[model samples]
Target: MKHVPAMQSLTPAVDARYQTLLRKLITKNGIGGKDSTAFVDDAKKQKLKTDESSIPLPVFEKGIHVNQAPPTSSNGLNGNSPTDDSTSDLSKTVSSTQDDRANDVKDEIMRNVLTIPMLKYDDLKAATDNWSDANLLGRGGFGQVFKGVWLNSLVAIKRLRDTDARNRELIRELCLNQYRHDNILPLYGYSFGGAEACLVYQFMACGSLEQKLRSKSHYPPLTWSQRYRIAHGVARGLQYLHTMTGTPLIHGDIKPANILLDQCLMPKIGDFGLARKGPYGEERTHLKVSRVHGTRPYLPDEYLRSRCLSPAVDVFSYGVVMVEIASCLPPIDRNRPVPLLSDWIQQQARDGLDFASLEDRLLQGTPHSNPGLCREFVAIGVHCTKYSRGDRPTMLEVYKRLDNLEFPGKHYM
Candidate 1:
């Protein structure tokens, strides 16, 4: 019997059994001599494999031991150690997975911040204080206008209850004309999130010209000078829209309610929801003239008969508003059934009625109570409300006429 080394006594029974099994495995695998020594040396250089199937063995005095399972291509086992390439590939796969997760997180964050699908209902509710009745400013055929505060700034919000196609078209047209001039209301934004559509505008403190004209206590009537200034301002605004912009904008629904006043009583056109761009060239026939789309009392005969409306339609509407400003009466007075405003004006012209009555009673105390200037304004209104659209002065002509008019104390040329 061979004398076993003293170091072998320190090995466990399982280790000794594994060594015996490894010897048998090496012989069965046809490993011997230098090849056997090489396999043993390779095995001794590595730590033990964690798998229970791997045999354990002690190092020889020469630091060599028989390999139970040497590195083999078939089993992917290599002396109880992983290859450099295999370890690197596994690390790369883990790193790529981490990178993909990071990219997914980044994409999700961007989608949340940048793109807003539609205005949220909660955000709108909070902005408008749940549409409180106190916020109500005015009502129209379409719906109500409300005062709202957003980001600590006052804003006017127009909510449309009517879902008419014409109303939708009007909203689209107004949005397109946002940058035309300061005389037109500035559209800050709009929301169509819920069943109802709402438009947001820079708030005008003084409200509409109609409100000022009809108010008794909280609101005061406009003086003749203020009225003249408003008329000129509105005419200039309309002229700017009709001629100066890249595309002529027609205020299809020009009325007193649509004319808003700023803090200094400067007139600014509002409610372009019914506005439309004029047809080009000979295709003017393509323009649709609805049956009396404007106020009945203010509707020109050409518009009443459904004739092709030009910018003159707006002129006609402005004329009625002008008359209303001068007379302090509603455009249509159902109580006095004598004639429509146009007919009454024609009769006044025929019978030589004094034009002084046409001046607003509120203007009696103002320094602008000059009968000569009042007559010029009445004449301008008369020309605007003419029976024929051709006879109505263009907004440009209106602006020039108003610009050249001389007041009692001030002269404009």
Candidate 2:
């Protein structure tokens, strides 16, 4: 067994930002003569009268970048709001002080997100044939994806729709470590191409799980063995994110489309723009977002009511993905009223439909000639999507259970 050091941030530039903001706040409040802690306490007592964000503070919230509303904390203690309890001047000032300190921590983080060769716009343009339609892979809400070559290596580059106000915070959060996993996609580097911002990542030759599931010819529906490996790999990737060396990170968006496959049919989870940190120095295991994002079927019942997110949410999404992987079904089929595969499958089970009936038509063998293993794989999926968060298993548990299920009886890295 071996260990690699987790990445650490280096933000000397941000270290001095707090003192500057602290002095500014002191001067603005005319509290230079008073003790800082005492002044803060007195200010907390005063009620806020306005709901305006007139103050420009360098506050950072997970998944929020430029032009996004600050996240509203579950307890209403963090985030910015347009109401009395949320937007009071005292609260704003106090929150800003904390934000400034956190910003320094974030600065060092963004600096080391990815360390690799930089790619200029010219390089990307040349590789992508000047962003030609021929190189275009697909277009989505975030931006357009293209297949290109740089330094003799193929790469997938995302050209964001809004260069100025998108995903910068995510890039920094990702900087906390270099991702090297059998399942997670590798982020090469990002670039500012004059009027646009683009992110570069290793090219997955086989496209996405959604594409393959939708059309079997999208390079052959994966074999039962491949599906088993993909399932375990995706689980391992989720576990890595949840219990990695650093703070727990919730993938926030987990779906088949977000799961890209390499030439060998290995799945790598991508699209982290909606990612979030679970908690900070608190007993809570979840955090609220500015708003709910991600596919509805994959979202848990609580998230539909409130935007609160935790590792369980990721597990829920993973379950949906696992269902699709096993049954070759979409997470949501609009043709059905319930739409969610979990709901649909559960209904079938209620009617006494057995495990053999649940396998995807394209899959071969008894999931490596072991019917119990096949049932267990799908059973784990069902357990992961339990309505109550407490009932759902942790990703580590899910991964271990699947790992023990066996995959062609070979040792995996």
Candidate 3:
């Protein structure tokens, strides 16, 4: 409940200095285009060294990747070639060696995938009441979600349509297993039968932030205070995902629907099916992807145009979500001049639009009415959704700003 002064209301000189500090941090952390090639080259050099060290010993036998000095005339190596039988045997040996290496790699990956508990398919089915419609929570393109009770605790079972996506499901589970944060949705277990795969997660009573924000009649419209809390929690979660993980992760799809609210209304970021590892080194700016897989409105222009993904994509999506939290407007609102919520918010911020004009109507007369905080929060979102990916602030910067906001409730770091 500490009250900190808003940066947006400060003098122009102070604001400039603040922005300069953010830029310095971004450059120091190698989050921009500068020096990216150097980082990549250094990483490639290190990888080459590792590869050379791990290279198998040269096979001296004939026709099997032999690396020997040219044979002398006394040895008759120049004129004589290996017999057909010897050649066939060498080829088979090489093929067998490759198969063994491939299997070893596959086994290692499977071991990592099995870090989480694997529940029996029958138990999951029983918990969901044999997949009854009454226990069904929702459905998506990949699968359906069902509410269930397992081991005397509530859980959500995401049952896939078929076994085709089992590999993807396991990959997601592996990613979730490595992530442990209060703002991250916890994975309970998974079940893979011969026909289908199911991923179990901790159940959230309130459902998604999208449902609460969009479906006002079914669920009470979130107050301004609640929205602020959700925004801060999500920012902290994204920051953790970007930096705290051994390797940074990009949550490709970061819309409101992917953000779940627990019983106490704490926000937890979920849905890792589209999540991908970021660049290898701290100095690398971005990673190029062959294809993009995220909602269009939440994607930045750089990613959509070049398919080069970075942590900026998530920042852009979070900005759009922030605008929604502030205005209660959908991402695609044809009624607005800009149409796109992120773009509209960015425009408003650029024009120094008053927070009052963009504030959610329901916030009026509420105890959460703090004009300075609202303006600063919206400004942070605008900074995040900059048109140029490099121009967007890092999640750490966003989190620090949110952490400084003054509010009545106890803050969770």
TM-score of each: 0.65, 0.74, 0.72
Q: How many backbone clashes does candidate 3 have?
A: 0
Most lDDT-accurate candidate:
3
Misplaced by over 4 Å in model 3 are 1-108, 410-413
| Displacement of the residue 392 alpha carbon in candidate 3, Å | 1.2
- Residue pairs in collision within model 2: 113-175
Q: Of the candidates shown, which would achieve the greatest TM-score relative to the real structure?
A: 2
Of models 1 and 2, which has the larger lDDT?
Answer: 2
How would the candidate models be sorted by TM-score, starting from the highest? 2, 3, 1
Give per-residue CA lDDT, model 1, range 1-413, as digits (tens).
01111112111211222244344445566555566555445545554332211211100111111111222221111122334463344334433433333333223322322232234445556778988889988887768888988768898877777454424433343334434576888776555555566666778998888888888466666666787878888999999877864346667777788899888888889877556554334324223222234566766665454334467788888887777777766776666664477667766877887776777776665665666666777788888888877788989999999888876645431
Candidate 1, 184: how far from true, in Å?
0.7
Candidate 3 positional error at 98, Å: 14
Candidate 3 global CA lDDT score: 0.67
Worst 10 residues of 1 by lDDT: 55-64
Write one digit per residue (lDDT tens) for candidate 3, span 283-336: 566754434577878888767655556789999999989878877778998898
* Residue 83's lDDT in candidate 1: 46
Clashing pairs in 3: none
